[model samples]
Target: MTKDELKQRICESVDRRRSQIEGIGDQIMVNPELGFKEFETAKLVANTMEEFGFQTETGLARTGVKAVLKGKNPGPTVALIGELDSLGVADHPMVNPETGAAHACGHNAQIAGLMGAMMAIADTQAGEELAGNVVFLAVPAEEYVEVEFRRDLVKGGEITLLGGKCELIKQGHFDDIDVAMMIHTHSDSTMKKTGVSTSSNGFVSKLIRFVGRAAHSGGSPHLGINALNAAQIAINAMHAQRETFRDSDAIRVHPIITKGGDIVNVVPAEVTMETYVRGRTKEAILDANAKVDRALRAGAMAVGAKVEIETLPGYMPLANDATMVDMFEQNSEELFGEDELTKVGHRTGSTDMGDVSHLIPAIHPMMAGASGPGHSRDWHISDKEMGYLGPAKSLAMMAVDLLYGDAEGAKAVMENHDPLMSKEEYLAFQEGVFRTEVYDGETGTSEVES
Candidate 1:
């Protein structure tokens, strides 16, 4: 079959499974499991993969599911990833009854899309003609949340790392893969589209604990070393450093005081803070982290408080393979109308796919799903027709084109790839760069149970 024929076949396949896929999305949306805890969600996807004849592996990177479809002959291997986690956004009507998780991030749609694409690839005749492989990965814990909970997971060895894809990468999940492609949902009027960005921010998280002496608040306030005061001072210092960060670098530093001592009248003995430092480049993030460390230490010293810093490494900056973008753009134009492919500027978000991109050539495109702002509660997949089918079609078409289409399709994408380092070199660089300190929540400053 020609590339066009395979594309049509895949589109038809997705259409055939539209109702089934939408049902899966609805079930996940209603259940709304949070990051690293997507047990049901993972089961649903893995079961689907097994039914479709893809070789499956579970418990990889702790709740992540990996399935691979090999062609008759070996060629380039491309991976399609689906995130299986949701955000803790408040006020969602379809909230999970027990866990309070909501699929505000529209990852349910992503999984359905991946499943649809996997089905098409499994049923495609191109497998006999093309010498390549397709990988379907349903990753858990992409959304970094509840630092204390994930930190405990790291400590218990349930997972080697925090973020799902990053942990998978560290486990050499993508070592055999060559190219990776996945579509994310964005709130836009257009039914389905592609987003390309030159760069994205690298992020790091830290939990800072301040220890001070407690004393009577009203009677002997002088005897108390105020930990809250130190926290306030640190926040103020972070705000002061904001202007120094370049706009192009897109530096974001936000901190929350998780614990501010016990009683209002009693002098606070201990305080804990959770903070994030994000920047457009790794170098910028590292530099900003150093400055943040200095300011936080200064704040603690001024209040006679001893401070402890525990840092969690996050996703590296996303560098989209331009070659892959071009191939995707051409393929998208062929599948949808030429107008379906639109230019999107840089977005201020992070993903574990960034880690995969660092390992091999990768493309992460944003597909339009809703009409309002992205990641906002107002953001929703109201138009199920467009929201469900469009993402599935785009992802399926990209896979078919890359795997079955003439080498020209894959060649265009590989030509524009700006790979800074080889896969081995990149892995080495990441090993040296990314580090996270796991802390037991039971021994937390304020004693929050793990």
Candidate 2:
């Protein structure tokens, strides 16, 4: 069959399983789970893959699930990925009452689309005509929430990295795959039907604590130091550094005080804050991070308190593969017309797919089937057909285009692509970001540091 004919067959197959795909998506939306703890979602994905006659594996990078579909000939491998995690949005209508977890970012749609692609490719027997393999990945913990919990997981050697894709890379999961793609749902109405950004930001996660002497607020107040004042100073200092950031770098630093004080009657002795320093490039992110550290130290020095800062590796900056983008764009345009497609520039948000893009050819595109702001309580899948089926057809069609007839499209992508870093280099860079420092303001020196 011709490439177009194969695409038609795949789309028809996806339509045939539309109800099942939507059911899975709705189930995940209502039963949201947090990062690294998506056991229920993982089970659903595994069962679905198994039912479709694919070899499935679970417990990857904690709660990740992988399914493989072998092609007719041994060639390059392609991956269709979906994130299986939700954010802590207690106010969302579909949020879990106990855990406060909600799929406000449309991850449920990603899983649904992934399953739809799998059904289409497998049921239509499209793999029999392709020269490369296809992999369906349901990864966990893309939101980077519950920092302390994830830090403990890292300390206990349960996970090497916070992001699921990064840990999977460390575990050698993507070593076999040569190309990858994933569709994220967007809330932008101006974007029409579909969109793809050229790049996005990377970040470093930080946890800060300020320590001071506590005493009775009504008596002996002079002997006490207020850590909340130090935190306020630190936040102000961080704001002061904003003017120095280069416009092209797209630096963003937003911090929130998690713990302000213990009691109202006593002078607060402990204050904690959490934030992410995001930038367009790794160097930019590091530069902004250093400024933040200096500001934090300044606050401690001013208040005569000690400060502990812990920095963790977050997602890398995404650079979509040009060749892969071209292939996917072609499929999208064919499916939804040229006017429905839009090309986006740099986006300040980040994703774990950036880590995968650094090593292999990848594309993280957006499909508009949702309404309202992303990660907000109002966000939801507004158009079921566009939300679930659009991505399904786009991913499957791109796979056929790349893997058909001796895999010329895939080879062209590999030939033109140059990785920013090798897998070893990437791991070393991320591991190096892990650091802890305790600076004593009174002594004007580092103490009890790690």
Q: Pick the lDDT winner.
A: 2
Model 1 off-target regions past 4 Å?
Answer: 188-192, 405-408, 411-418, 421-450
Error of 1 at 400 (Å): 2.1
List TM-score per model, in order: 0.91, 0.99
**Candidate number with greatest TM-score:** 2
Superposed on all Cα atoms, the candidates' RMSDs to the truth, in angstroms, are 4.3, 0.9
Query: lDDT score of model 1?
Result: 0.76
Collision count of model 1: 3
| Per-residue C-alpha lDDT of model 1 across residues 322-372, encoded as one tens digit per residue | 777877777667656677777665656788777777767788877766555
C-alpha root-mean-square deviation, candidate 1? 4.3
Backbone clash pairs for candidate 1 read: 75-131, 323-413, 324-413
On residues 1-450, what C-alpha lDDT tens digit does candidate 2 reach at each position? 998899999999989999999999999999999999999999999999999998889999999999988889988899999999999998999999999999999999999999999999988898889998989999999998999999999999999899999999999999999999999999897887889999999999999999998989898878998898899999999999999999999999999999999999898899999999999999999999999999999899998999999999998999999898888778888888877878989999999999999999999999988998998999999998889888888888988988998989899999999999999999999999999989888888975433
> Candidate 2: deviation at residue 75, Å?
0.7
